[model samples]
Every structure is written in structure tokens, then in C-alpha cells.
Target: MPKIKDKAIIIGVDAVLPALLAQGVSPHFITSIDPQKLTYEKIADSADQIKDVSLIAAPYVTPEVHKIFPASNIFWTFSTKSIESWINSMLEGKILTSGASTCAHLNLTAAIMMGCSPIIYIGQDLAFPEYRDHAAGVVLSDPDQIKKELGVTNQNTVWLDGVSGGKVPSTRGFLSMRNHLEHIMASNPGPHYINATEGGAHIAGTEVLPLQEVIDRYCSETIEFPSRLHTALQDSNLSNTKKLLSGLNKALNDTKSLSKTVNKYDKLIHSILHYIRSENNNGAARSVSDLPILLQNKISNAESLEKKMDNRKHLYIWQILGEGTMEDVKKSECSLHEITILAKQPENFMLSFTKNLERLLSLNKARKNILAMFQHRLLHIINFHRKEKIILKKIEQKKNMEQNLFELAQFYFETGNLVLAQPVLEKLLALNPDSAEVLFYSGAIAARQSKFEESEGYFQKAQEADTAMSKRVLEFRRGLGGIYFDLAGIQEDKIYSNLSRKMLFKGIRYCSNHPKIKQEIIYLAESDLTRIKSALESGTINDVETILTVWHKGLEENKNLAPCITDDQIAGFHRHYGELLLKKGDLDGALKSMQAALKFTPDNPDLYATAAELFFAMQDFTNGITHLNKAVELDRSYAILWENMGDHLLQTGEINDAIAAYEQGFIAIPENINLLKKIGDCYLENGQLEAAREAYKIVKEKYELAQPPRT
Candidate 1:
């Protein structure tokens, strides 16, 4: 292996990073995918050991992990999510796609993308051999190190054909990983795939040999990989730095920033939680349809935010960070029944949704911070490419220097480099304290930095300095409004609410031409305001559920007054309410609501799914399957729904229909290999011995690929 250490561009996933570093093998690149902070904690002890290794990361990677790596060293890795194609056009970095879920698969993917040949898999055990999960250097968490929790039993276990000729015990997860590796090898031609781990389950489509022997044959000569890669990266970063800087700057400068999406979705999830809690009150509102109106922004507003990005869906970032919220937003509001039935799972669904949103909120906020870090680093990179004579010498005059430095401060401020922009803006204020642009920027900077009093003074001064600076003053006031607004959400204090309203009203009054800062949205915010002020004036009560209830009620009541609300949105509200009512056992209410919804737009798929499950649970198989068929006709990708249909059919002596539904379920979700066994059982029950035998055979082969527990 030492003979060609320089020849290969070895890459390791975060799983194998510690072991590799311990072995003194400095891999050129590392891959990371898991979103949990645990993914970062796993190899954090070795942060110093791998500062130079490039990170190939998905946007879902925990922000902590991104922070540990050098800003210039990190590159994007994706899980094949449908990111808006325009995202690639904005960055010059080479985007790498990682296979789903496993460390080894991602490593292999990273290697192949780097033009590596004869891909050798080392310690690639698709089985937990001898009940040992990892090699000597790796320290696993306590739960992961335990065996029985994996549900591996002798009866449940399937044996795999091993590399050294004996059978190996394996599990469903490792078996899936093995198949994924095989698929990659099959699809990508010209890479000589070799498995160097002489123990563990055998991988098809690869030659198996001992590591030493494979190295002896393949590593006869050395090639300079480090300098080659370093040179290539230098060229890429230099060419792309300035262009990417502009995009990053614009994103941070956005008022309808990604934060708006976060605020909207956070409210939606909270509104759902509140609605579930309010159901017992018997009088939360006559408008139980508040949910869908609250839900309207999850899709429409998010798409609006994306379109506002130069009128394009530029926020593929949401696809990465805000998975739960984005998934809801991606679906049509009326069809989002995935979490609609809260009456059955109020606590569980609320906890899961809130936790997921919390993670997404952290990740989204983290991305902005990450982009700021990237922006700061890119500025440094751009400086390296600057022609000193052209850039510095020409701006040497006092006046010219002030203008140039002010522009430079604006760049820094726009991309959220407040720390750097602080000193520059201070210098500009020193040069021209009365400059409205400079004062307005100072006010914004102070507001974001939480110096609210100082920010207020700066905004007042800026306004006084130039009576014509209404738009900038309006924006400055809005910034102040946002800070107070957030504080109000956290503390639920009337002081913060009043202050927020004061700033928002000031913004609206100063720039009446700005269409978005309407009295309706302000009143909507008032509906969200405390019992003291907004509640006193608008008669909208303040409490968790009532605050949200009135908020949507305001949106609905002002539909004719506000451009944002419409008739279709109101219908979507009824659909969601009916969908939940079906689950809640209010059949008459559901039928009325459903009919109202159908009148606006007939044959809603979510309505069909809700009714189908309701009927299935009530033992009305004939009607259940009929509704299931209609739902499946509208959307065939719902595997669990298909399984529900199959289970109902199997229970009612419809063997043929049962088998067909199970097959469709299997087609919809190929990950659950156990579905094949269910199909086999149905075939056997129907006395089709040969068909059962074939289906069971395939299931057995896959099931046997891993041990019960991955040691």
C-alpha cells in the first residue's frame, strides 16, 4: 500500500475517518450525510487530524460538522433530491452525488467521481462478523454497540454466502447497502471493482482478494495525486469566488429572506399543534377551518419566496435544510394528509413535527450563518486574485478611499459579515456622519447586532438627514420590527408586541407605496399581538391557540381586503378540516365539509385517502377497497396506503385482489423486502406453489445478506 500511497485519491466517510487517521492514512477527501448532531460528534475528536481533508457534504449535514472543516475545503454532495437546476448555475463548485444512507456507498461514490480506478473495498463487511460491529480503533455509542436491539433472532436471521466460502449472517439494512453498491458498480463501466475484505458476505460484481495481494498487484507505481488535486481546486475556487460572492450577498440582503419561510412554516406547525390542543375546548373558533388557511403559505408562500429570487425557484437550499417544512410545502395544501389526522396522534405527531421543524430551523439558520462564513472566506479568496495596482492604488485619494471603503462595507454587510463590516462602517461614519446611506446601514447593522436603542437613534438621524430616504428608512424600521417581533414570540410580552407594532406602523406610514406592508398584514400581526393592545383593539384574544386562530381568521376575514388570500385558499381550508373530521369520527360534519370542498373542487385525493382508511378501520372492506382504488388511481406512489388496501383485501377473502395490491405496494416501496414474503404468503394461500416458491426464493436471498445485528 505504501508503494502507491501518492498514486490514489483515497476518500473516507465520517464513519471510517477516525480509523483511517489512526492508521496514519491521510485520505484526500471525506464524506458526511447524516443530519443529526451525532453525525458530527462521531468523529469530532479527530477534527485537528483532518483539517486539510476536503469535505463532501450534503446540505443536510449538521452545521457543526461544516464549521469544523475549512470553508474552502467543503464541497456539495447530494442525495438526488430535485434541487432547482439553477442552483448549479450560481456556483462553480463540482457537485457530487452520494448514494442514499450508507457511509461505504458514499465513499465509493466519492472515489469514482475522482476518477479512481480498480476501486478496492477494505473492511467492507456487509455482515457483523463474529458479533464485532467495527474494527479496533472505532468507538461506537452504547446503544449502537448493543446487539439484541437489532431484533436478530435465529428464525429471523438470513445467512449470506461469505467471501471465504462459509455462510454469513446479515440483516435487511446491510443487504440493502450491498445491493446499492452492486448497482453502482454495474452502472459505472471501466472501474475494476475489488473487495479486499476476505471476511464478511461476498459482494457480487467484484473480485475478492486479500488487501495485501490486491495492493501488490495494483500498486506497482506511484502517481502524484496531492499536487494534482490541489492545483485543480485552486483554479476552481479562484474562478468562482467573485461570482458566488454576488449570489451569497444577494441572499443575505433579501428582506423576504429565507427567514420569512422559516417564520411562516414555524407558525404553521405551531398552529397545527395548537389546533390539536384546542379541539377539547369545544369553542376554539367556529372556524375549525383555520388550519388550511394557516397552511396556505407552506406551499404558496414558499414558492413565492423562490420566485422572488429573480423570479426563479432559487431556494433549493430549503430542499436540504427544512426537510419537514419543505415536504409539506412541496405538496399541495389540500392534499397534505400525511400529518392531518392529529386527533389520533396529537402528542406523537406534535412532538415529531416540532422536533423536525426545530432541526430544520436550526439548519436553515445555520445555512445563513454558513453562507456568511463562506462569504467572508470568498472575499479573502477574491483578494488573492486582485491586481494590487488596479484595486488599491487607484482608490488612494481620501474621497475615493471613502467611497470605495463604503462600497466594500456594503458588500460585507449585504453578505452578513457584520464583524468585518462593523469596523468599515465605523470608519465611514467617522468620514461622513451625516451620510444617509451610511447612517441607514449603521442602523441596520445595529438592529441586527441587538443594539436596538442605538439602531433607533441611527434610523432617526438617517431619516432626519434625508427626508427623501423613505424606502431605506422603511427597511430600517422593518428590521427593528423583526427584532421586536421575534422577541415577542419568545417572551409573549406586551412590551415587545407594542414595540413591534410601533416599528411596523412606522414602516407602513413612511412608505405607503410599498404594497406588501399592508394594513392587513399589520392587522394580521395585531391578531398575533398580546391581549393587552391588539386584543383590546381587534378583540382577538391572546393565548397560544386563540392567537393563531385569530391570526388565520384575520387572513380569511380580510380576503377581500388583502391580495394574499383567495377563494381557492378558503376551499383548501374546508378540505383539510373534512380530512381530519373523517379520522375524528364526525361523519356528518366530514360529509358536509367534504361536500363543501368538493363543490369548490371535486375528487380530492387526500379526501379519498382519509375516507378509505376510515372505512377500512370500521370493517367496511367493500367501500374501503373502492375508495383505496380511487386514491391509488390519483397517486400510486403511496406504498403504505397500498399495503393498507392489500391487508384489507387479504382479510376479506379477496386473494387475487390482495396479491395484486401487495405487488403494487412492493413496486411502490422496494426498500421493504419483507413485502415479497407477504406476496409469497398470499400466493401460497391461493395454492400457487411454484409462484410462492419463486417469490420466497428472492426474498430469502436478500434477507440472508446480513446478520441480525451489525456488530
Candidate 2:
């Protein structure tokens, strides 16, 4: 049990009330309110377990609730700039306040105001595990199925109405919440923040506690004895039924007492189970298939509304400009109301604003009236349609491209936007009947969909195509080999290993002259060998050793291929090779091979930063600092580089310079241990005992007890 002042303020919502109260934790609760359903009394009543509650926008609390809360306990706030004056006046120095985004942001704001040491979050469930609309009663459904049925891709499923909460909720509110949280955390720096729950999306720099642990903490530590009302009612000798009802009402205030109610419901659960068994069970499954279509209609309607609103906004803009007089508009304040007024009378604004107004007035009465009201609107619609037409034509042209289809398809594929790439491949295959490249990729897609025969057919066609492509024999064989390798990756057939080996052999034979192709072939062969060892106990170790030996020999013989490779790829190869050598008990060999790989990429920041571990293993600090300095010079932007360098400096006994370097590095990258420890050691070396102690204390307070960094 830590002292109350030493502990962090825990920010949470309704789910955490019982748990926090049980721990005697008097944390500041920041309530998020829906303006349309604003009712201060309801929230206050629900959160009765807590001693204090801070309201951001207390939906107009009733007189009773208002009287109960001290004026300082509540604060009025809004994310929109429209209420800036009111917010500033009402919310000054409030310990907790809500923001437009995630509660994390609001919690960070609250932490800053309190000058708390660290902000820890509980019950910070930011997003749902599955696609769900963010309304009270919206049912969850599969978003993938909905996209397929609608024949369109929709990344965002929610359509949050900007009006009062009466509109059907959409993802807009959730995204706005997430965006707001990120912005506040990025902008403000004071108290450290950590999330203590794992059942939500991962937030950086936060520690995650298991959900079961949280649940246990809530159950074991929270105070939930029977309420005062229950005792009075029981002593009155009321009827059994009346006593039961009284107990239920009293239990609402006692968070722990809810378990008794749950226990009492066991009989009811059994009865419901009996009824479910007696009744028909097929109804639920039958209706599940229809959910996608229902979602499609909702999505379509929302899209239509969005288009209509865009049109209205554009037309209104043109209408305001057409009608406004230059002097009248210049004299008037720019506001939505003034623009609306001008929109209804385009001619009045045009008469003063345009030099051609006199000629416009000379036109025929009917034509002039029509042009004044709707000419711009018609032109806007026509222009939009023309743009759509151009896009459609490009799509068609993309489908018709012949020789360059592979490159074009690859461009789309690498972007992680597969919708367009899939169709492009489909079109390219239609034009070229024996295209091994198209067949191989198409087969990969089919494999993902579990169309095994179709994948096999594509691989077979690729093999045939390779044999016939005499002029482009090397390219065709490589493509065919790739298709076979993919087929091996997907198929669970007994012959998959044999097929994979043959494919690798074929690719190596054809790609002997092409270093890039040879590199890919070797990489794929290595990957298959890893799986083969695990799946087949009797598999020959010689088979794997031969592949490794050949790869090493090839690299030693080829220098051009080594320099041309990506840093990540080189790092991956070195890591795997080192691991393999270590498994063979060849530690020195492993160290040498890893060092050689590092020498080839000495300027790689990630490699340099991690070099200390290797040097430390070898009991050498001199080389470590040299490598770290190179790392810092190569990538000054990496947060971990300076931290590693600081450690190396401290190890070598460079007291004064180490302190300066650590301070500079820590300024660049916060929450780094090497810099913190090195700075403290530097202070100790210089006989500044107090400064050393303070540096160590700050590091312990902020980093030692901080949550692990998340993915």
C-alpha cells in the first residue's frame, strides 16, 4: 500500500467506479456527456460509489444533484471553439476535464492540472474488438461480409451526426475521440501516463494489466456491504417479497453486494437454459446470413446522404457569392447566417459584386431567372460527372494494359490496398492465356480463399508457360517457380515439401545469372526448410545444411548483391545465420559472422545501437562506443541511439562528457534508461551526491515503475 500522495490519479469511466471505490482510491473521474441526452442526475446517481466526480458537460443537472455537488467539483468544457469563453471561465484549475477524443487525452489534461506524478488509466476500452456502431443499442456485425455484399469498400463504419445525440451513431464519434486523445498526449508533456488494462487497442508507452487480474482486484478489494436502507427494511418485518425488493434497491448502492444478486439469479439462469433447450434452436443461425444485406442498405443510405449534403454545401457557397454585393459583404461579418441570407437571393449579391450585372439583367426574363437560381448548381453537377467519367475511363485503360501489367499490379499490391490489384490481375490474365506471372499471383489470391484446385491449376499452367517461353526462358521459369512455391505455402498435401524443393531447384537453375532472382530463390528455400524440420521428424539435416552452405558460398563470391540489398533484409539474414550457428555450438563462428554482417552495414542505426550487447558479451567497451558513435552519426533521429552511446561512455569512465552526452540524448529521446543511469553515474563521479540522487530518483519514479512499451 503506497501513500495516497505518492500514488497516481487513475482516470476511468463507469466500469471502474466499484473497483476504485473498493481500494479507497479517491481518483478524479472525468465524465463524458452526450449533449442530447444530458442528464446530470442520472450520471451522479450511477457513480454514487465514488467520493468525487468531475463533470465536463453535466447535461443540466437537477436542483437536488446540483446542491449535492460543490461548485468546484464540476467544470464546463467543450472541444469546439464556439464555447471558448465559457469553458475558460468555468474550467480553470479543474483536476479533471473531458476532451473530444479518447479519455486518455482527457486523463492527460486532468493529470497536468493536478500536477500528478503519473496518470494511470483503468477501464480504458477505446474501441470494440469487432466492428460495432457506437450507439447505445446498435448491434454488432461482420464488416467484411457487409463490404462484399455492398460491392464497395468502407473503412469507417460509423456516421456520427454533428447534431444533438438524436442521430443514429456512427464511427465519427469514436475516430474524433481517438484523434483528440492522440493530439493532447502529443502536445502536452508532464505526468507520465500508463494504461493498466489489456482488453483494448494498444497505446504506446503504456503498461497493460491482464483483464482477469483487474476483475479479481475489483472483486477482492472493493467494499460492498449491505446499504442502510436494506437494514431498516429488514428490521421492519416486511413481507418476504417486499424484503427482497428492498434488498435489491439497497444493493444498488453497495458495489460488492451485486455479487449476491448475481448468485440469486442462478435459478433463473437454469430456467432460461431449460426453455432454450425446449424451444427450437435453428432460428438464430438462419437469420445470421441476412445481416450483411441489411448492413449494405444502411451503408448505401448513409453514402447517399453524404453526397446530398456535399451538393447542398457547394451550391450554397456559389449562391452566397453570386448574390452578395462587394461592399455589403465586406461590411458584414462572415458567418453562416449571413451566407444563408445571400444564398436565397443570388441576384441581389450579383448586382453589386459583378461588373456584368447590367448585361445579366438585359437577358430574357425567364432565362435570367433560371440562370440566377440554378445555373451554378447545374454546372457543378456536370463537372462532378465529367470527373467520374474520366476515372472510369482510366480504370478501363488500366484493365487493358498488356506488357506493363505486372509492374502496375505490383505497385498496387505493395501498397496494402489489394482491391484494385486483384481486379488488375484478373484483367491481365484474360489478355495473356499463358502468363506465368499473372497465373502465379492469381493463384496466391485463390489460395487465401481456400480454392486449392484453382491454385493448383494456375501453378500447372505457369509450369507449361515456362516451358514454351523460349525467348524469355529465365523470367518465365522464375515466375513458374514462384507459383509452385506459393502453392507449397498454401497446400497441406503430402507432396508439398517435394514440390517446394523441386520449385526451389528449378528457380536456382534458371536464375544462376540474375543475382536478385537467386537471392529470392535462396530466401524462399530457407523459409521452406524451417517448416520442413518442424513437420517431418525424419527429414535429413544435410538437406538444410546444404542450403545454408550454398547461401554462404554465394554471398562470399558475390559483392554486388550484398551492397544492393536492403538493410532490413541484410539484418534478417545475419540474425538467422547467427541463430543457426549458435544452435551448432559455434559461438565464435556466430560472433564473427554477425560482426561481418554488421561491418557491411556499419552505418545502420538499429544495428549500431544493439552492438553494445554483442560487445558486452565479448567484454569490450572500446569497440562498443566506436560503433555507437557511428550509429548516432548515421541516424541521429533514432530515440535509442543516444541512450546506448550514453551507456558506453559511462562504462569507459568518461565522467563529464558522459553526463553532457546523456543529457543531450535524453532531451532527444525521453524515458531512456541508459541515458538516465549514465547521467546519474556521471554526477556521482563528479562528487555531486545530491544531483546524482535526484537524477536516480527521477529515473526510478518515471521509468522503473512505468508500464512496458507496447506494440
Candidate 3:
């Protein structure tokens, strides 16, 4: 018999006993210490190995008092905190022994005392997320090297990754201890260490094994194979087990059941694989779907072969035994005894089947590890996004209120309410002085009130103070030039008109120099040019090609400019693109563009109406009805959506739904004579004679009241 070389050392708090005994650790040499108590009685009851224990009456024990003779094979020294210190002192006399330390420093001292090599650490899970109390495993020591080695230590306490449930060490205490240990290891660097368990983090001189391998070898090895087999048989994923049982059940339930025949086994496999796919796909796991078709095809081919190999003896043999047979037995003697040798192929089938099952288990284990890593990382991303949203919302609310204040100031200025306007403008300027619209309005008010000095000062300040305006200064100059033109028309002054024209030309030149600012300025220039066309020649203005060039320039500024474009503007641009396509008689392109527009502007009534119109033009009545319904749902205030809804229903030959739509449209815009007439027509079309008469009577009375009374 081979010699059993396996041995172990135990070191921990009170919870280490279960792990020690399970690993077949001997009871005669184990020692435990109790620092919380003053006498040996407190610990002796808890120490499983001891028959009796005695406490030293004094603070320290001498070598003679400890009964340390040269012949002593095992020294079971019992002390609490001072054990490592005493061992270190004894090392000066060249005496070597194995013992555990109370802390990292003490652990180091004990190692030096023993001159130990290759420390195998276990049960050091101090930083584990939950209180483990103990690991259900043991650390084995080699008996041959027992005299040359020191005791193992449990030095795991603080953790770095808090999300993984690792404990955070106190900065003043464990961190300082950790730093000191690192310094010592850096300076000395001799004793090798390996972590036999993985719950704790790596300290200065240890490296951990692959965690699952450790769990399997240590934690799971205690579970008997029979117990694991029983659990596996019960698992839902093992469909072959279920199918085999079910077939047997059916065969027993009905003796003549078709499922019992060798031909039906292929059907059983096909049915089982289909069922497995359904169950696997119900979750998002694609790994389950990756089963090799060769296994399934083999089962099918075997079933066909079983059907062909027919004789009364063959049938009887198949009924008694399952799907395997030897070639010699099948070809030669049709004897039952020879058929037993054919059962060898079942082992090969079982091997392939078991391989798949093991693959699934391995995949499940990998999936669990991946999920753990994601759970830690995703928590931080979600937290950051939440904070960003909160900050953005606060900025938007403040911006909206400030915008409303600017609008109110404009209303007051336009109504010649100078006193009321002055205070509001001053307050707005304090908040956002660079707002050109506010400055322009203020300057216009000053000029109108004959405050020449104030107006000049305001215009000059507006020109200098406007940051956004400087980018498009020519546009503002053109606006001021238009104002000058209007003033000249009122006063009949050629000088003012010529000065305005000069200003317009100057503004256009300045804007042309900065092509980046040309798009918005050109759009404004187009509108202004139409207003001043009578005073200037047509060729004096830039062509449409020039304006398009400016548009292209603006587009080139940023390829990924979605966030920079305001949400409403993006929606409007898509809607315009769709409308342009529709106007060009490209209905398919229009529909696609409209759909893209709707993705951004789902609530825009005008875009929905245009999409409905395009769909209607394409003779897609069902789609037309759907978009019109969406349009009305988005904004009930739109009389046009209801009218469109009525028109589509009428076209589709649903008179009642049409009448209802027209009536709804009339209710919203009662002042519309055209809508009132349409409601009457809708009533007439629906064959509601009395309703149509009443609608006409209302319209006729309104028409008569609006006419002259002198007749």
C-alpha cells in the first residue's frame, strides 16, 4: 500500500474546527488561544483535542515551566497575543518551530522564528461581502516537511473592490498595517506564499488560483457523486433523461404504444431537441442553441437502421435491450445471448451526451462570472447618467423663464410702453447682455422716442456687447438699414434711403467675409431683398446658388451635430425635406422621409398631416387613415387634422366616421364658415336629413346677420 503523505495545519478563530475535522486532521496536536479570558478554563472547553489544559500563574513562562525537553515531538504552546513575540525571542537561540501570528507583523515574526518555506494560506476571507464565519474546507500540510515549515496565517481583512462585497479597511488601522507589510516584503522578499482559497484579496506575498477551480476542488468535492447525479437527473435542462423516462412510462402504460418501437426513438430525439430550443430561446442564452446537429442526425439514422434490422429475434432483442447492437450478432446468429455484446455503443452515445451537458454547465458558470463583473460596472454608469440629467433639467428651466422675461419686455416696447419696458430690459440685460435681440429692441425704442444721444449710445453698446451678433454683424446692419429705409419713406428723404442702401451693401460685404455665418444671414437677406426690390436692381442681390453654397458651408461645420441642433429645428428640417420630395412627385421617397421625420417629430401635427397626404396620394387609404388619426391624437386643437380625418374617411366610404370627424372639426373652429358648410355637406352625404337641415339653418342665419340691414 502507498504511504498516505497528505497532512495539514489549522489556524483561525473559533470557527476553524469544522473544516479541520472534515479534512481528516488529527485531534491530538491542535492548539487554540483565548485572549478575551484570563484563565485556561475559558478555552479548554472549546479546544476539541485537549484532555486537560493548565494556565501559567504568571505573565510569562520559562522554558523549564513549559516542560520543553529535547525529546518533545510536538510543542502545543498556548498563549494569546504574546505567542509570536516569545517565538521571535526564542529564534535568537537558533530554535525553530511552527506557530501562527496574531497580526501581519506578528505573522512575519513567527515565520522568521521558524525559518518556514512555502506558506499555503486558507480561511483568510476577512474582506468577504458577508460574514462567512468559516469556509467549509481545509488546508492540507505535507507531513514530510512538518519539521522544516512554519504555521499558516490568516491575513485577509481589508478589500479594494467594495462593489464585489469586499470590506473597506479603515485608513488609520488596516491600511497602515497593509502598508507596513508591503514595506517588509519589499525589504526581505524570501518566504513564498500561495492562496488556497479565494474569497479574500491578495496580500503582499500570495497569489490566488482560478476561483471556480478552487470552489470545485475544495467546496464541491465534499458532495458525493451520487448526490450530484441525482440532482442532475432532476434538472429540467437534461431533456434526454426526461424523454427516456417518458418513453418508458408510455411503453409501460400501453403495451402496444407506438413510442416503444425502435423507429420512434428518432421522433423522441427530434421532439426533445425542439422542446429544449423553445426553453433555451425563452431566455437570452444563445449558447444553449449551439448543440451539434451530428448527434441528432445520428439518433435519426439509428432509428431507421433499427427499423430495417427486422426478424422476430431482432424485435424481441430490441424490446428487451435499448438502441445498441453488435455487427457480428446482427449479421450471424440470431441468439439473445450474442445480442448482449451489442450494448457497447451505448457508452459512446452516453459520452457524447454527457459532453453536451458539461458544456452547458461550463457556459452557465462563465455567464455568472460575466454578470458579476457587469453588475459592478453598470452601477457607476447609471449613477453618472442620472446626475447629468438632473443638472441639464435645472439649466433648461432657468433658460425658459429667462426667455419668457425677454418676450414680455418686447411686448411692452412694441406697444410704446417705455417706462414699463425700461425696467424689464435693464433686468434682462443684467442676466444676458449679449442677447442681440434684446439689445436691438432697446436700441430701436431709444431711437423712436427721439433720445438721439441715448439711441446712438445704445446702438454702439449693442454692437460691442453682442457676442452672438458679431458672428452675424452684417445681418443686424441689414436690419438697421431696413429701418432707415422705412424712416426715409416716412420723411421723403433721399439721403436716408441712400444711407440705408449703403448700410445694406456694407452689411452684405461684412457677412460674406465670414462664410460660416452666411446661412442664417442669407435667409434673412432673402426676405429683406424682396421687401427692397423696387429700390434696387435684381442682379445687385446674390443668386440662389450663393445661398445654397452658404447652406452647404453650415452643414459642413459638424457631421455629428444632432445635439447642437435644437430638437424642434431638427424635426422641422426633416418635415421640410419630406415636403420637398412630395412636391417633386417622388411619393416613395416622400413617405420614407416622412417616416424618418415622424421618428423625431411624433407629436408634430403638421408633419403628420403631410405624411397622411402623401400616403393618400399613393392610394394607401389604410395608412392615410392611421396617420390622420395619429395627427388628431397629438393635437386636438388642430381643426385641420380633424378635417383631414373627415376627408380620408369619406374617401374610404365610411360616411358615419366621416360625419363624426367633420362635426369634431366644426366644434373646434366654429367661426370657420367653410367648416360649417363642410359639416352640412357631411350630414347630407350621411343621409341625416334633419341634421343637415339644422346645420344649413345655422349657416344661413349667420350669413343673413352679416349682410346689410338697410335693404
Pick the TM-score winner: 1
lDDT at 616 for candidate 2? 46
Cα lDDT tens digits for candidate 3, 108-181 = 43444344544444545334223322353321111212211212332433345321245433223444555555
Off by over 4 Å in 2: 1-8, 14-27, 38-44, 47-72, 75-83, 86-104, 130-173, 205-711
The local distance difference test score of each candidate is 0.60, 0.47, 0.45
Worst 10 residues of 1 by lDDT: 541-550
Error of 2 at 559 (Å): 85
Clashing pairs in 1: 132-711, 133-711, 158-704, 169-706, 169-707, 170-706, 170-707, 171-706, 171-707
Residue-pair clashes per prediction, in order, are 9, 8, 3
- Which lDDT value does model 3 have at 296? 53
What's the alpha carbon RMSD for model 1?
32.6
The residue-level lDDT of candidate 1 at 515 comes to: 46
After superposition, the stretches of candidate 3 with alpha carbons farther than 4 Å from their true spots are 1-15, 27-35, 38-43, 46-92, 95-115, 132-184, 210-711
Instruction: Give per-residue CA lDDT, model 1, range 313-342, as digits (tens).
Output: 435544433433454344433333443443
Predicted candidate 2 versus true structure: per-residue lDDT over 1-711, tens digit per residue: 113312323444422333445556544544443332212223332333445444433323232233322222454444433223232423342223444433345456756665664455544545443322122211111233333333224455553322222222234446566556656666666556555543444445554555344344433433222232245435753334333334333322232232222223333333333433454632242222322454335434434533542354234322323333333433343343454465456444322222222222222232224334443443443444454445556556765457556665665444433434567788788888778877766654443323445655776676677754333444544564454344334343432233243333333433344544455555554464454355335544333443344445435544434443455455545644554676676656666666766766665676665554466456676776666666667776664655555567678887775776688678766657657877887899889999999999988888756868779
